[model samples]
Each structure stands twice: as structure tokens, then as C-alpha cells.
Target: MTEVAEICSELLRIDTTNDGGGDGPGERRAAEYVAGLLDEVGIEPHVFESAPGRTSVVARVPGDDPDGLLVHGHLDVVPADPAEWRVHPFSGEIADGCVHGRGAVDMKGTLSMTLAWARENARRGARPRRDLVLAFLADEEATGAYGAGHAIERHRDLFEGCSEAISESGGFTWHEGDVRIYPVAVGERGTAWMRLTARGVAGHGSKPAVDNPVAELARAVARLADHRWPVRLTPEVARLIDELSRALGAPIDVDRLEEEIRRVPRAAALFRGVLRNSANPTMLNAGYKVNVIPGSAEAHVDGRFLPGQRDEFLETVDRLLGPKVTREFVSFEEAVSSPAEGLFDDLTAALLAEDPGGRPVPYVMTGGTDAKWFARIGIRGYGFAPLFLPPGLDYFGMFHGVDERVPVEGLEFGVRVLDRLLSSESSTM
Candidate 1:
């Protein structure tokens, strides 16, 4: 296999699924694999565990004191079903110029690039102007409680004075039919996970049951999925609109911006299904036997918030899911609060230099990430996992979808951009 293919395969073989399901919880073997590789390259890793098996490791390529840049990616990923997937999720198959498996896209692909970079930089003894911190984290697929959350809570000093960090998104090569644009995620929406339960009368399935809990759960699920999140206009969205206007060479109505946003290559992905506040009924529990109608049913919903809109998001959630639902932070990552001033300047220059035809626009990921944890310590989190995807390929759908994979060439392209970024961003500081 080629280099990028190799990276994807190796990571795929690691089986780092998150706590929501599958092979995760304890990142021991996966973390050890990364830590061992870094060790081979002579970087001592600082490994921390939140629980037996759960782990987050940090290896610093030491640089100037006080302010360092952290490059992070999570190890855990959402579970995959072999029955639904074309390839075994953990088989780490490299085929047809792509690496196929779970975490291949949602991250592991990006993580592999970071690992490759560590080797490239370490081999050259290249010294960053600021300390370069590499975090091979776990539990991001869950709440990050055992991964980044634990690291921040327990190993705050390791990230001491970190000003900014980069992670597994954005800055990748995107193939528009005519243009290649790298959408850098400067921010992400906050997450609010809620648990809902409906309790009613239990009865024999043979008998016509009324007020059945299962029926209530089905209603609640419909309510959550049908409820729309209020359209929020954020600084990131405004920037995106500006870019699209220039690209289309016409005034794309801001009111119908959602449709216009979809016109831009993969970013049309940003306008995915239900392009608003969303609540998903991910899990459901009911009666065990067919002979009985369960009296109690439960479900979990994932909701998101725009930056500085957490309180408002909470209010919306309360109104939509109903007060009976138990609201909680399934995965809480604060939306980037501060403006990305110099950070974007450097990133934009890098993208422009790499793909002059490509547009580097600001984006706000609708999901949560470890970036939220880093943002807490005064570190600005930018999703800059560079990739150049070919047209017609739905990149977002590959998050954990069947035959999840990354382009062989795209990985190489990402490494080139990352190399320039690490070189350019570090020197400028």
C-alpha cells in the first residue's frame, strides 16, 4: 500500500470505537500503538487514564516556552455494523486507492496524517518556534469524559499556555466540479444530549393496550426529530455567505442561504439533511417480550447550539423535547468563543498558497469535538485536517458510513498542506 493508504490501514486495525458502542472505553491498545510509534521516533509520551482502559496521551516536540501549538485527534470512533457496511469496519482495508474502515474519515484518517508528520518532523529534528503538542486522545466519540475532558481536568499543566490547536477537520482538499475549496472549521456548535422516558400502563400484548409507554416513546421520538432548531446566523455563516456570493458571481439571497450554501462543493454538505437545530432519537429501550407492552420506554437525543447560544439552545431544547425529558451534556464542547484573528490569517495564506484556485472559508461544525476542551484553556481550536476530495464523492456522509474511506491522493494532499501549515504557522509566531 502507498503511504496514506498505509496510515489509514494501520489506524483502521486499531479498533478504537467510542463508548456509545463497539470497541472503545479503554484506549489501551490503540493508545499504546500511537505512543509506541511516537516512542520509536524518540518522543516521550505523557499518558493519562480516566478509567481502566480509557486513555489520552500527549507527546510534546519541545519548543519555546509559555506558548505552544497542539495538534490533536481522537482515537475512539462511532461503532460500525458489519451487516450494514461493505467492508468490516475494523478490517483496515486499503483498496482502490482508499483506506476503508471506521474512523477512516470521522478522524483516524486525519490522525494518521498527524502520526506521519511526527515522523517527518522528528526525523529532521525540526524545532517549532512554539512547543508543538501532539495529543492522541480517546473517548471523543462519547462525551470525551474519559478522553480530552479527563486530560484537561487532570493534566492541565501539559496544555499550560496553549494558545491555539488544530484537529481532524477542515483545510482538507475539496474537489468542487470546477474548483477546490478547503473549508476550515473555525468553530463548532455546542452539544446538549437529553434522555427521555415515557411511563404508562403495561399490559399483555394480546390485549389491546392503551397509554402504552412504547407508544409514548414513539411519539416523543417523532416530536424530537420533527422539531426544528431555530436558524442561527453566526459570524462563520456570514463569512461563508460572502465566499459563496463571490464564487457564484451573483447575490445569493441570504434568506435562502441554506440552498446557496449547498451550491459550494462539499460544503453543500454543511447544508445536510434538516439544516437546523436537530434532535435525534439515537437509542430506544422498551419491553423485552413480544407478549407484553412495556410500561416504560427511554431514548436519547443529541442537540446542538451555536456559539454563545448555549443558554438559548437550552431554552429551545426545553421547549421542544418537553420538560419531562432529562437534559444533559452528552458531549459538551464550547463553541469557539474568541475570534480567530491571526490564526485564520496564517491558515488562509497556507491554503491560498497550496491551492490558489481553492477558497478557504470559515465554517462552524454542527457537532462537538475535543476542540471544545482545548478552547477552555484559552486555546483556539481550528479544525484544519486538510483533504482534497474529488467531485461527486459525499465526504460528510463518510463520517462513519458504509465503506468509510479517504482518498489516497487526498491524504497526500492533506499532508502537504499540514507540512506547510506546521512550517509557516510556527515560524510566523
Candidate 2:
């Protein structure tokens, strides 16, 4: 527990804030720190950069069995503003029984736990039944272009023979009606980041123009923002609804599924975003000068679609954008889903053993992760960081949020759960 908290605090101190694209202070420093820790335990980690300063580290521990397992996490974090936070965003202050920093909960806490567990195993010369591959990735806050995406494209051999992987955002405690439910991610919504452009004749602001591109773009953005997306459940979400209903002892009526889903507090939060594809206007650009109307107005949208909903999502976007507006994908990644039946039992057992009151459930993430990139190589990825958080904490708000922190106890709990899973005989069973 002490070592876990120490490692998490150390990792948080190193500011690896990823500002997207090729910008920001890359992950080289943080990767070097992680590599140093691994090296101290007699394991030589492979540290490489996809682009200049964009570093990622990978290492493996041999086991008795030939099959492989991957444990991965991101080194980069989203940019945080100091002015908006109570403490300096990069301070890494350990106070109030929590490790306070930007990436404490979003990832570095889990990264530290993985590192500590691996280092401990290396020190004791203890190995599991299958090879354990550890990957500390970069550029996850943006797309994984310089992280997992780069690794899969340039260094495919590193993950060869690895059938499954576990990473962030899962195995955490969720309280609902006196039941502590742990929702492990089995699926992620597809990313459909698009840019919308509306074109019209340039004119002075004082002169009234019926065909104003800015006005048209604003209207389109408003429509997309206000549109009530219809509920369309994917298989993963449907399973979640059914399982949650049974777990809560509230049998769902299929004819009135939406009503029942809303009735369950846990189901409402987990299924709302996944029940429908979503598109939100994020950035907008038009004229530079106040007096002149630009001929073209452009806006960026953050879009997410469920599995098998791509065509319908795109068609809806086209209709909302109207005739003058044209759209193109800035970045796109397909939705990923993995079978949770057999694999889930192990995850559930681990959580239940640690805290008998916990009930593990399967849910879909509303956003994307490096898991999407790994899916291309035929490797299934599950979001299973394994933290046992208390009821008072807003776990989801910590991601890219102000004054982000993770409970010291939660970090310790995660270390134990990860150790149990990694040291187990068979993760598949």
C-alpha cells in the first residue's frame, strides 16, 4: 500500500499533459521514469518514441504457459488549468487521504499499481502461468496515433501471441441502493470526430444577408445540440440493462424498458450515453474581423456511435447539418465489443473476494480509449483498472477535470486486486 501510493505520487509529479496532435511536453520524461523503475527490479523495459518526444514503454515477464496477457496504461494526461483548480494541477500533493494531481484517477494511479506489481514480481522471481506484457502508452488523451496506434503499426511483434488485454476505467466500485456495483467495461462507443463547413457569400456585417454562412452554421450547430437522440440499445447495453435489473431484483418489462432503466440509478448513468449515438459541437470558427462576414464557417463536433449504428448516425448528422453544410471526419475509430460471459466471472470473483458486498456488472464507455487500436490486431481489451472507491467520491468527474485526485485507500485496494489477477493461475478461467 505504501509503495503503491508512493509510485502513484511520483508518476503524478511528472507533468506529461498531452495537448493533442504533436503539441505539449510529450511523454518521454514520464516513460523514462517508468523505465527506470522497471530497470531497478532487474527487468529491462523497451522504451521507444513514435514521434520525437512521444515515448512509450513495453516489457514482458515470462511464465510457464505459452499464452500471453497484456496489462497496459497511458502515460499522457489531458491538459489541466491551474487557475481553475484548488491545488497546482501538477503538484502531486498527498493530502486529505488522497493523491491530488491531474492524472491521479484518470490513469497514473493505475499505471503506478501495474508498475509496482510487475516490479515486485520481478524482485521475487515470481511468474504467472502466461506471459504478462506491460505497455505504458502515450497520446491516449488525443487519438493513439503516437501511442498504441503507432505501436500496432510499427512494432506489431511486441504484442504478438497476446490474445487479451486489461487497462483503465474499470473494476471500480459504484454504489447503488446499498449495493456496491463494480462495472467493468466490455465495450466502447465508436469515435466519429467530424468538422462541419457551411459556405456562403462574404459581406459586411452591417449589410443584411439572407445567405450568411455564420448564421447557417450556428443554426446547424443548434439543431444538432438540441436534437433529442432516440434510444437505440446495442447488445452490450442490453445485457447491462438486463443484468442490472436482475441484480437489483427489479425485473425489466421489455415493453417498458426505458422506464425501467431510468428507475435504476446505476442503469441510468451507465446506459444513457450508450443508448444512442451522440454529436456535440465543440469548436467553431468563422470571420476574423468583427465587421466582415466570412464566406465559410466551420465547426467541429465530437461524435460517438454505438456498434452497428454508423450509417444511421451519419445520415442523421447529414440531415441536421442541412444542405449548405458539408461534413468530414477529422478522426474516426470503430466501436469495440468483447464477450463478457466467461471472462467476467474472473473479474467478478476478484472483486467479490476483495469486498464481498461488491457486485460486478458490464457496461459500455461513452468515449474512446487505446483499446480501439488494439482491437485492430485481434486482441480484445477490457477496461479493468480495479479501484474500490468510496461512495462520496465523484469518480467520473476526475477525468480531465479540475483538482483531480484518487483516494490513498483506493490506490492500495487497486494494487491488491491487480496483484491477485496477475498472480492468478488462469485469467481466462
Candidate 3:
């Protein structure tokens, strides 16, 4: 097999930063690079650009069976400042036995493993048990509108027979004493990115203003920020707690979940973010100048609700902001869940086969991914990007953190695990 690290370093050198805003340089260069790599191995690649220079690449490698498994990763990384890093963020430097770069862990590293594995398979004339639909997507750091969303909306036929998908955000090693716990994400919290607007009569600097929009919005923002969201565990989270309890050989009291979690901090860390609904005031805007009380004020909130808690979450937000403020969605996407029985077992088996010391568990992601977009088309997605890291590596904190990097050995381990999973007959629908 080809050196996955070399592919990763090459990819990281290409700066494909998605700044959420539309104006950043798009993923065209990276998409072309990915296309060329696949083409070199004789795998026909289909490249799509939703807008000018916003590109995504897709290819279907035929297998022994007609059933398909979609393996995907985004080509973009969250923007990084070069001054804040030990190495330049865009320079895909290999140092201290790790690949250091912006997208090393956030996604491009995983894409490298996929690309290298696929290339090796193609070169050897090897085929997976199930057809592999490889998608190197764009815009996942934002809303995936130019990536998975566009593909699903305009070109649904690209993923015709695919029933399940594996993507970013899971299958990494989480240490629990001697055992390495690998959490496989079966679901994720729904996104309710909302924009709140408050309107009041314009007023002078020193005037006694009763209906100050700024004050009204500030109070609402504070309430939303400080309000304690009740614990509402969905099926996936509940299952995770149960699995952890068994794995650790300690009972977890659901009623006293906060207290119980304190005892098993390591296991609790896995699902702490998805235990309840969360809303934090991310951005606030009120007055143009300090003196004048603006007629209108607005704020943006980052809100996430557990699966099946959307109605209750929205209702509570409306009540907290009161009658003065009205809210609209900046971007809204539903929570998604896939069965953790069949293909999930296949994933577990693959991981265990690769590393006997590893224990596989199901988890629900706190943040959203391209999985939710693909869920719209009845495709179940799982977070199955496998990586095995040495102890002391803060894998979770490096998602978009400074000095984001992935261990070279971890990428190699992932390649092996992926090969085993794809070769399994049970992977087919």
C-alpha cells in the first residue's frame, strides 16, 4: 500500500479553508488534486463545482456485490492563523512522528487514508465486497450546501444503491485506563442556528428609553446563555451511558447522572456534550455608536437539541426571548440516527480484528456533520473514521484547535481497519 502520510501531507499543503462566509478561496485546487490521484489509479472520478471554484469529487469503485457503502470526507478545513501555530498552518509538516496541518485531524487526514487505500486497491485490481462510493466533499466546515447538500439536491443518482455511509468524527482511540475505547457515532444533535431580532423605538443618548432594543436583546441573550437546559437523553445517548456503565463495571444512576458522571470522568467525557439541549449566544449586535439607542438589535445563537427534542427546544427559546424578540433560522438541520445493529456490528468486528485491546461503543455526536444532509435522502450515516493514537494525544481537542495534527501510526491503523470493514461481506445492505 502507498504511504498514507505522504498523501495527507500533500493534501494539507493545499489550503482549502472554508471561512463559513462565501468569499474565501474555494476547494477547486484540492478537488483537482484528488481527481488527478484517482485518475492515476484508473478510477474514473466525477468532479462537480456548485459555484465557481467550489468543487467536490465523487467516484464509485465497483465491487463484487451491487450493494454500496458510501465513504466520505470533506476537503475543507476551518481557517487557521499562521502566527498562532508552531508550524505554518498550511505547511503539511511531518514532525515528531505526526502530520501537523490545519485539516490533519478535522478531516483531510481521514481523506488521505481513504484515497491511499482506494488507490492501492485499484492498482492491485482488488474490489471490496460492497461497492464503495467515495466522496471528497466541500463546505462541510460550514453547512455543506456546496458539498453534500448540492449533490443530494441536484444529483441524487450519484449515490443510487448506497444504504449506509461512514464519515468524519468517530473511530478514534479514547483511553480508559488500559483499554482503548473507540466510540462509533450512530447519531448527532440537531442544529437550530437561529438569528434573533428585537425592535424598539429609536431614542436619544440621554433620554429615558423604556423600550430600548439593545437592553431587551441583551437580557434575552443573557437568559439564553445562563438558562440551564434540562437533561433529555435520546436513545443513542441512553445506550451510550448503558454501554459505558457495563464497560467500566460501575452502575450509572440516570436520575443522578451529573453526580454519577463525576465518578467515571473518562467514560462520561464521551457523551457529556450530548446529554441535554444547549444554546449559547455566539454573536450580538446592537448599536452602531455608544450614544444612540438603536431602533433594532440582533443576535445569533448556536443552539443544539437532542434527537426528538426540537419542538420543546424551540418552544423554550420563544418563551425565554419573550414577545419583544422574533427569531428566524440562519441554518436549520434535523438530528439523524442510524441503526446500531447490523453495519454497526460490522464496524465493531473490524475494529476488534485490527486491535484486540480496543473496545467499540456507539455514541451520538454533539455537533452536526454532512451525515445529516445525506440523511435527507434516506441514507444512514455513521461516524467511522478509524484512527489509533498513542496515549497522551489529545485527539478530541484538536478537531479545529491550534497545532491540529494526527499521528502517522494512527492513519496507518485507520487504513487497515477500513480495509477489513470494506472487505467484510456483512457490510453490504
Task: Report the number of the highest-TM-score candidate.
Answer: 3
Q: How would the candidate models be sorted by TM-score, starting from the highest?
A: 3, 2, 1
- Which of the two candidates, 1 or 3, achieves a greater TM-score against the reference? 3
Q: Write the per-residue lDDT of candidate 1 for residues 1-429, one digit (tens) a residue.
A: 555568668878877767565236437888888888789888999987888788778988877454788899998888778899887988888778788888888898898887877777677777655678899888887777778888888898888767889896678655555656677787887776777777778888998877787876787678767876667677676776667556545665668756766565354665342235556678887889999888788888776667777777667666665544445565555566445568777777777766778877777787878888877777888888878787766777787678888888878777766677775233211
lDDT for each candidate structure: 0.74, 0.86, 0.89
Which lDDT tens digits does candidate 2 get at residues 268-325?
7877778889999999999999999899999999999998898999999999988989
So what's the TM-score on candidate 2? Answer: 0.94
Candidate 3, 252-323: lDDT as tens digits: 888998887787787788888999999989998888877898999999999999889999999999999999
Which runs in model 3 stand beyond 4 Å of their true positions? 24-26, 424-429
lDDT at 145, model 3: 94
| lDDT, ranked from best to worst | 3, 2, 1
Looking at candidate 3, the ten consecutive residues that score lowest on lDDT are 420-429
Residue clash pairs of candidate 1: 26-53, 169-385, 171-386, 172-386, 172-387, 173-387, 173-388, 173-389, 229-277
TM-scores of the candidates are 0.85, 0.94, 0.97
How much does candidate 1 score in TM-score?
Answer: 0.85
Please report how far candidate 2 places residue 25 from its true position, in Å. Answer: 1.6
